[model samples]
Target: MASTRPRDGASDKGAARSADALLARMTRASAGRTAGILLCAAGAAAVSVALPAVLGRTLDLLLQGHPDAGRALAAAVALTIAEVVLNAAVALLAGTVGARSTAWLRLRGLGRLAAAAPHGVSRFSPGDAATRLSTHATEAGAAPAGAARIVAAVLAPTGALVALFVIDLWTGLAFVLGLPVLGLLLRSFARHSSDSVSRYQRVQSVMATRLTDALGGARAIAAAGTVDEERARILRPLEELGAEGRRMWSVQGSAMARSGVLMPLLITAVLAVGGLALADGRISVGDLLAVSRYASLAAGLGSVAGPLGALVHGRAAARRVDALLAVPPLAHGQRGLPPGGPGTLELRGVGVSRDGEWALRGVDLHVPGGRTVAVVGRSGSGKSTLGAVAGRLTDPDEGEVLLDGVPLGTVAADVLRTEVGYAFERPSLQGATVEEAIAAGAETAPRERVRSAARAAGADDFVRVLPQGYATPLEEVPLSGGELQRLGLARAFAHAGRLMILDDATSSLDTATERQVDRALAREIRPGTRVVIAHRLSTAARADAVVWLDGGRLRAVRGHAELWQDPDYRAVFGHADASGGGGNR
Candidate 1:
């Protein structure tokens, strides 16, 4: 069944505020690099505007056969060279800033993902997360450089208009008359293209997520004879993506075409007016030449569409990245745990809800130090929820959980992590080698202790047979279900804390291996409170106490021997008699 979490009215507003703050933070972080890029771009723009006027003067000097023609020519050449140098500098600086910004945003996104609660991270598909970190981050990073180009693009035309007005008022007025039309075209393009680009990106993310899901379940799809259907489903979003792409192209193409036509008309009109002015002797030949060039420059303003589009697309991408960053992380506390305390655990009237349904309700239980308690129940009976609360993997919606009289919510993160260890049914051991996986999170453990932990989990023998033994990379060692479970157990055992909660961590192992592991855990590992979520009746029977949960409520908390006396308790394990005493172990 799909779970539904209740939403608060303030959540949307809060998320918007957080996203705005994140955008501001990113802008601040890239400020120094952005400034450098802008300076180079401005220098290039200034040279570009000055070169035409200089060239005009040089042309006039040669036309009149003046002695200063040589100096005028030299000045034009120097300005051209300077423009080239400035442009090269801008390109270098822009690339540098883009790369740095991408790296920075990617790192920040990863950190936020790490800090978020498991459920929050689970909301994003792996493929979607990858796209955000890579594609979206890169696009968003380009905004600063794109913004600098936009400023330069705007300045070129503005500067040209001013120079034209100073040289010849009639030519300048001709150029200015076309400005409103160009502005209108650009404004329409921006509006339509922004929406289209945003939609394209969203559809791309959806398609990637569907493809990833299909790939992960390819074996199941093949077995079910639904490969074709799955493929079709994954590609379903492609049509929408294509439509959006076409819309963006059409908007950009239309704007560019309009600019292309208008630019030539404006330039021709300025030349016609300049010709009349030259004929009437209202302006010199040099002034006519400068005005014509400035008119062409003003027309080039239409080229702003490309950089402006990039800036808009980048802004859209930044919003997507910020959405991920805004997922609220689990709050931690400031107090540390007392040293050397017993691993006594207590739950006082705890309740938890998921998707608007109570997963656990008004439950209370306690375990003395150095004792093993097995949490057993039917599926959806809150066994996992109990274990999660015990270890502070999550907090209860109501009531409180305490470790040695210290509220779990009030315990500092470092102290809580060091004192409470957890091993999941499917552990993600992110390490290069078997040794490293076991030693992860327990980097201070001595070599001997690592070996001892591995041996206790019955993993040392299999690990030793590998090519490099414990040094063998995990990817090189393809492990069976039981072997993988053992490795996970070994890691948790290596970091055995004052409280160890195993959430069905040993379910993959065979009965014999499980027995050996249990014996080793009792004999070798440090004494601590052990809370095991169990399915087999034998596991519960072997524990010091059994916590039976039913319908999100605690049914009983007693020894397995005492609970087994009830027929209903026996039925919980789907047993008529105790014939299959081990409960499918």
Candidate 2:
């Protein structure tokens, strides 16, 4: 089910605001590099604008047989070299800033994903999130440096236009006459290109999402003999993606084509006007040469569209990246758990809804300190939801949950994490090594404590037999489903506090191992409240009390033997034996 989270409705204004804010933060993070890029770009522009005029004067000096011609020629060559060096510096600084910004953005994105409630982050599929963090971040990170270049990009043309007027007013005026056409071409391209770029990105995101989903379910696809169909489905968006890509190219081509024809005509007109000025004795040969160069520089205004297009792409990508980072994080407060308090977990009128359907509603229950409570229900009967609430992994949409006397929402983030631990059906070991994975979440899980937790989960024996024992690299070790669950259980045990939630965490272990782990929970683990989301009847039987959920509400809180009398409760295990227990391994 798609969980409804606290993200904004993805309104255009909201997304733009978030994108701008995120870009601003990136700009600040790369401030030094951005400043350097701007400095280099400005220097390059100055040299570019000055070099043409100097070269024109050198030509005039040579034509007039002036003694200073050699010195003027040397000066022109020096300016040319300086321009190349400054442009190279600009490129270097831009590259560094872009790399730095991409790293910063990725870290921020990952941090937000980690800090948010799992369900909140779940809104982004693995593929979509991966695309946003990797490709989209790279695009956006290049924007600030790109923007700095735009300043110099614009300055070059404007300065050239001013130099043209100083050389000959008629030539400058002739070039100015065609400026409106150039402006229109760029505007049209920007509008069309921005729209096409945005559509292209959406298509890419869809394909990536489908491909990721297929990879995750590759085994299912293979078993069903539908690998071919899956492949086709994953590439279904290819047509639209190609169409958008072509549209972007067409926009760019049309703009460049128009500019291509218009620039030459404007330059020709400037040259003709300069010739007439030379005929009228209004300017020297040096001034005419300078005017012609200035006219070409100013006429090349069409090239601005290229950088503008990049900025547009960057902004669009920023919106997508910010969408993930903008998910409202689970808010934490300043309160901490009182020292030496037992974890008495209570849910009062707690209700959680998914996709507009209630997963749990008005399901109030309480577990005393140091007691084991098994939450038992049929599939989709809110058992896991209850576990999530008990550990505060997710907050109920309505009402409140409290541990001891403190409200969960009011607890400090670190305090809440330290006091609550969770083990899920599919545990993702966090660290590189086996022992590190087991100790990942604990505030302080020393080597001895890690080994103890592993022993309690029945994982120590198997772990020690592996190639490197506890130090074995997680990826290099082969683990069965049951072993995975044991490691997950060990991780929870290592970090277990006043409240530990095993949410269908032991479903993969055999009955004997499961029983041993259960015994260890009571004997070898911490003395605190344990909320076990159980599917096996034996698990409920071992708990101090059982919380039975019917539909979305709590049906009863009674002993397993007492609740077994109800045929419905027995049928929840998919068996008719009221006296017989159920198990799955």
Candidate 3:
């Protein structure tokens, strides 16, 4: 089952708000850059407006048969030079701001995700998360700056209107008639383009998800001889994605065709009207020419339809980007670990649920400073949940978990994270070298500490056999599942947290190796709290106390020997038979 909720029908107001907030932050973040951008946009608009008027004046001078037509033409040439300079400046600013804004938003989005991810979010796929943070942010951030170009495109029409009114009010009114039509055309394109672009985004997301799944399952599919089936499954979404792309291009192509025809048609109608007015002597020959020039300027309004198309694409991308940024950051609770004690972990009537199904219920457990507690249970019996709760990898749905008599939420995130160490059943190697993996995210851990931990976990021998030994990269050395698990344990050791929770950390080791690792851990358990969640009953048997969980509930808490005599515990360890009680290794 999927782990995250679908965001459908959710209030997008929050997303818009976040986008605004991000922009405000970015504007403040890059104030110097923004000032440069605004100045360039204003310059571009100024030139864009001046160019059409200069052309109108030059045409009017020529029509009036003025001997100073050469001067008017020279003025037109100067206006052209100014237009080029301004346009170039605007383009430079747009590109610079677009790139910078994309970077800012992408970084901001990642920060939000990191802050929000600590909360139990099972459905967040790594592949999808990458898409949301990178590509989506890039597209969204382009919208505001790209709007500058659209602003210039609209300026053409304003300049045209001013020139037309200068020619005659009737001619200007006639030209303005086409404005509504152009708007309707743009509105239609925006609607369809936005819809198609959104669909394309969904299709791309699916293809990405399928690709990640196929790659992750490549080993399984090859072993099962179903490579062809998996290939077909992955290809299916890609094909759909291709089809959607073609559909979007077709819609854009159609919009382009209409724009091409509409602009020239409007121009032709204006010229014919101007020609008639000229014959009737209601407007001067120069006035007619200026009106024609203005009509031509108005025709440039169609140019915005293209940028408007870009705006729609950008807006669609922005909405997706904003959605990621809008996820309320995991409510940051109190700072520092709870007061009144130190390094004593407590689960005061804690429970955890996922999708309304209880994973752990009404369980209260504690590991005081300098003590060890072993949690034993069958698969799906909540042992791991108990460990996760203590480590704060997963928070409790009810009640509270405390470190040193203080609620876990009362502690700062970094403090809680650093103080609690977790070794998972199938741990991930997050670093390149074995040493680096062992050190985890810490800035400093002595080589001796890492090697010592590896030796205690029975991993040093294999690590030494690799080329370059501890310096050998994790990818270069083919470490097996058991080896990785041990390295993961060594990482926890290197971290040396106040409280350590090993959730089935040694499950992959052989009986002898498990016993060796357990003994080493037992020797080192003093002065640091340890909570081991293991399936093997033998491991729990040696603990100071045993916690046996069943059906998401803590069923028994007693010494290993005492629990061995109980029917429920006997059944759990397969010791119900008269032949033998559950043996401890």
Candidate 4:
């Protein structure tokens, strides 16, 4: 159920705000570097202007056989060298600023993503998120540097215009006349290319998302013999991406062609005007050469097209990064749980909705401390939703969840996490080694404790046989589904929170192993509340109590032995009786 449609207007506005915030952050981070870059560029422009003027004076002195010709030549050479050095400094500083900014943006984006809610993070596919972090981050990072170049580019033309006027009134006027045409061309390109670039980037993200989805499910697609269909589906966005790219290029090409034609004509007109002035003895040949160079330099401002294009692309990319950052995180209060309380859990009038449909509604349940409760339901009956709310993985839209008499939302994040542990159906083990993964959240957990937990979860024997035992790298050890599930259970056991929630965490285990693990949980683990989302009837049969849900409403909460007497309850598992004992074995 990933969203394939483009974002709506309100989301776009939020993204714009995020983009602005990011730009502000970049500006703050690199203020000193930005200042240095602008200073160097200004110095380079000043030197560039002085060079042509000095060269013109040298020419005049040589033509007249003046005694100061050598001095003028020396001044010209010094100005040329100064310009080169200043330009080089600008490039070096701008590059450094860009690199630092890119690093900062990527780190910030990742931090924001980590803090965002699970549902919010799910909006982006893995590949799309990677592109935003890598490619889009780099592009957005170049904004500060590109902005500096743009300023310098504008300054060059302005300085050239001033120098031209200083040389001769008629030549300056000739250059000024073409300004409106160049401005119009740039304005049009900027307007057209911004939309084109934004669309192109969106299409790129979509294509990446589709590709990542295909790769992750490659085995399934191949087994189903639908490889061709999957490939076509993944590549479907390429056609739109190409069209957007072509539109951008066409806008740029048109601007360049127009500027190309207009610039030479303007330069030729200025040169013709200078010639007329020279023939009338109003200006020297050196003056004519100086004015011509100034006019060309000013006309070269049209080449700002490249940097302007970068600015546009970077702005669009920043918006994409900002959209992810804009996802509001779950709010947690500043209250800490009271000390020395039993791990009692309660849900009062709890309700949850997804896509405008109720996943759970008006649900009221309570589990006393030291009791094990099983949540039983058929498909789409809110079993997982209840587990998630119990662990505060998500909060209900209505009512509240309480642990030990305090609302879950009121508990501080650290206290809540350390007190309530969860294991999912498909666990993500994220660490370098097996031991590290087990001890991930509880970093201070002792090695002995980890081993004990592994044994309790029926994982220690297999782990001991690995190449490096608990130290074996996760990638180097290829584990089956059941093994992975056992490791996940071991991780939860190692943490040993006051309240443990296993949301179908034992589904992959065989009957004997699961029963052994269950027995170990009862005998070895600390006494606390345990909420298990059970898919099999046998699992429910073992629990002290069962919370039966039907169509998002709590149908009953009673002992498993008592509930089994109801034919409707047995029918949920498509069974006549609980005599078979082994469910999904």
Candidate 5:
């Protein structure tokens, strides 16, 4: 059973480090956008100072018994309008910059994950990866937007306080005195609240995973009469996620409430002091009003601490992205392959392991170039592992796998992929049309070659009957298992590589279509250099040589006719006589 316990200290530390790294990467990736946003924030701050300064001057003009006090009041009003306009412009600019930066970060991070995630990692489920990319990227984006707001909010108030000080230094002193309390609030909230936020994010991931699993296996669950049970299992995680969300919100709400109380209370104190100064004639009424405005400004800064907290959260989220980015990909393969005939394949003490399980044991095998070889094995017999090694999908753990006397690891991956094509047992098609799927990753092949390959794979007839034939989009079209297999075969044929490894590629097709494809492949393919991993005895029986594997080791390599004589071999298919034997290999 899977463990339900949450991760512990070491894991949390690693996650935190990863989150930090993600933020650093986001900073680098969005540097220009950040600069643009900061510029807007600075402008917004400057505009915010205009209103208070102008209002103070207008009041001063009125108090001096200016005959044109009305004009001065009008000027203040106009300045206030101008300040609003400037604030609007800056807000728009900052929002645009933040949006574009988020897009770039999300796109690049997702692309890198898709590319680097295929090798080495064993637990990168599609559902989990999708959740990480989507949720983490969204949370990370909040940092920049929040940072822009925080910069403007902190600066406008701070600038107002400085201006107030220039008018009367005591007011500035009062503003400065309140900052220690604000700092305490920030530190306390951040230290305690960050963990809750991280916890909420983790719960969200678990909920996403469970939801994806339940939806993807809906058919299976219904058929097994476990729909209600599966639904409960998925909903349980979501409930846990909701509880975590509530806890975080409660913490945030309490911190915000305390900050809210402190800000206005500090403003009231400043007002009382300013009133005493005004009554004593130590400060003019205009100066008292300005000091009041500054007090309000400081209180406004306290409110901004909320977005500031969001900025920190966003930075933490970006750290997750950074963790993924820092993981190095497998080194690029060499540039070329050694010149040799197509079929000269050899394995020298090769082995492969994944997550501590030896997928393939140390084994040596050599097959001379120019003949069809069949690999016969039970399920989990390392048959697919051998095919993967031969195709260079992965590197071996212990020893060398050579193609044409050159170690596969030394040959460039692109070249290896081009020269050694794989037709998987259930090939993943990646195109709108049959032709497009066949032409995938084979840039040099022409449309005519794609057609020829389809015909060779016995796929031409069904394709011709489609609404648009080669132009028909695959999305709306339904294909049977056999038809899909034929399409996979068409891709292999179109590739025109020297070494072709078909891993149970014909298993789903009827015997007639299967034989037809086999015959076509035999005639068109370069006569010797083919490896067929098959569960069908009919396919193996036709190969030039059959290498039988059992219990992770190769037990025999001989002609099908010779193998038929072995009682153990015959017994495998539950056959008493050679001619009577017919079953999946």
Candidate 6:
């Protein structure tokens, strides 16, 4: 249902604005490094412009047999060294700022995804989310430094042009004549580069998404003998991805090639005009050399293309990253339940919609504390959705769920988590070792209690026999489906709160083992309010009562023996009640 949450209304303009704000925040977070980059770049540009002017003065002084020639020449050398040092500093600072910003973005983006809840996060695929968090975040992180570099790239050429004007107006005007063409070339490259990079990155995500889906279902794919088909499906976007990549390089290459030819030609024209000025005694020999060098520096506008392209890619990636940020999380309130209250749960008019269809509607139910209720239904009958709602894994769209007379939404997060426990049909084992996996996320899961939980879930024996017993690394232990389920159950059991909802959590266990687990849960484990989303009639039979669901509605709540008297309820377990029932009459 979280996967079907419809993206919570993200518009293009809104996401872009959010992306802009995120980039701005990153820039602000690294303000010191960013300012250092700007200072170094500005200092480097100042040295670049100053070097040629200083060298020209040195040349004039040496030719005139001036005694100050040695000092002038030394000044030029000093400016040259300063330029290199400052440029190096800029590079170092840029890398540091970029790295810090990337880490910050990843943390915030990851936190946002975590707070969104499992159901809400299903909107993004594993691959898509990974790419957004990893690749796109890295690209977006460079935006702050990229912007600073761009200012420096522009400032250098602009300063050179002004210096040229100071040396000779005619030479400066000659260089200015080609500015329009340079602008056009850069504009075209930027527009084309932005389009191609966006397409390329999007296709990369598509392939990654397909690849992740296939990897998750690898066993099934092999069992179905469709490995080749899946390979083809996953790689289907590679061709388009390649095309976009080539187009990006083509745009960049074409612009660079054009600039390569145009820049030298403009420099030649400026030099020729400066030569004429020299012949007319309008400028000296040193002035002509400075004019030529300044013309080349002014024409360095072409070099801006590289950094500008990076900026475009980063901005596009920011949009992708900010889209993840735009997903609103499941908000919780600050209210806590009353002390020592039994975990009675109630749902009133609860409705959950998924992809324009109601998965659960008008479901009003209640369960007293410390009792087990089996929720039985057809596959799509909202049993799991109800479990999620009961524990607030997801909030209902139209109604409220209450625990101990307090709205679940209003419960403080820590109190809510400590009070409700859940085990999933396919739980992801967390942590590095068997013990840690069972006690994952708990602040203080004593080792003995962890062992007790594992024993109750029937995982203790296997864990103790492992190469290192409970200390065995999870990677070193190959677990079957049922074993994995037991570990998940143990995790839940270790933290049995006032309310525990098992959403088909025992589905993978063998009959004997599952029966043993159920018995242990009732006797060996601490008791709690239990809501079991059951697909097996045996599980329902063992519960105090059954909550039957049919087509998104609650049909009846009765003891399993009583519900079995209804033909429709029998059909839910793939039976007919042929002898003594007429649809619960």
Give the alpha-carbon lDDT of every model: 0.84, 0.87, 0.74, 0.86, 0.74, 0.87
Q: Which candidate number has the best TM-score? A: 6
Error of model 4, residue 296, in angstroms: 2.3
Tell me the alpha-carbon RMSD of every candidate: 2.9, 2.4, 3.5, 2.4, 3.4, 2.6
- Model 3 Cα lDDT, one tens digit per residue, 304-334: 8776776677776776666666666655465
Query: Scored by Cα lDDT, where does model 6 land?
Result: 0.87
Question: Candidate 3 has which clashing residue pairs, if any?
Answer: 3-123, 4-123, 336-412, 338-406
Per candidate, the number of residue pairs that clash is 1, 0, 4, 0, 12, 1
Clashing pairs in 1: 4-355
lDDT tens string, model 6, 257-332? 9999999999999999999999999998888888878888888898999889888888889988887887788899
Count of clashes in candidate 3: 4
TM-score of each: 0.93, 0.95, 0.87, 0.94, 0.88, 0.96
Candidate 2 per-residue C-alpha lDDT over 1-585 given as tens digits, one digit per residue, 9 for 90 to 100: 111112335898888888988889999999998989888877877888898789888988899999999999999989889989988998898889889989999998999888787778877788888888999899999888878877868887888999888887788899999999898998888889878988888777777788888887778889999988888887778998899999999999889899999999999999999999999999888888888788878876878877788888889889888988887787888899879788999999999998789999998898899999999988889998888777777889998999998999999988998989989999998889999999898486889999999999999999999999999999998999899999999989998899988988999999889989998998999889999999887888889999999898999999887777778888887766545443321
Ranking by TM-score: 6, 2, 4, 1, 5, 3
- Local distance difference test, candidate 5: 0.74
- State residue 423's C-alpha deviation in candidate 6, in Å: 0.7
Model 2, which residues run further than 4 Å from truth?
1-8, 576-585
Which sections of candidate 6 miss by over 4 Å? 1-9, 577-585
Question: Model 1: per-residue lDDT, tens digit, 129-215?
Answer: 887788989998888788788887888788888888887788889888988998899999888987888788878778778877877
| Model 5 Cα lDDT, one tens digit per residue, 456-483 | 8999999999999988998766988788
Candidate 5: list runs displaced more than 4 Å: 1-15, 65-82, 117-119, 338-340, 442-444, 526-528, 564-585
Worst 10 residues of 6 by lDDT: 1-10
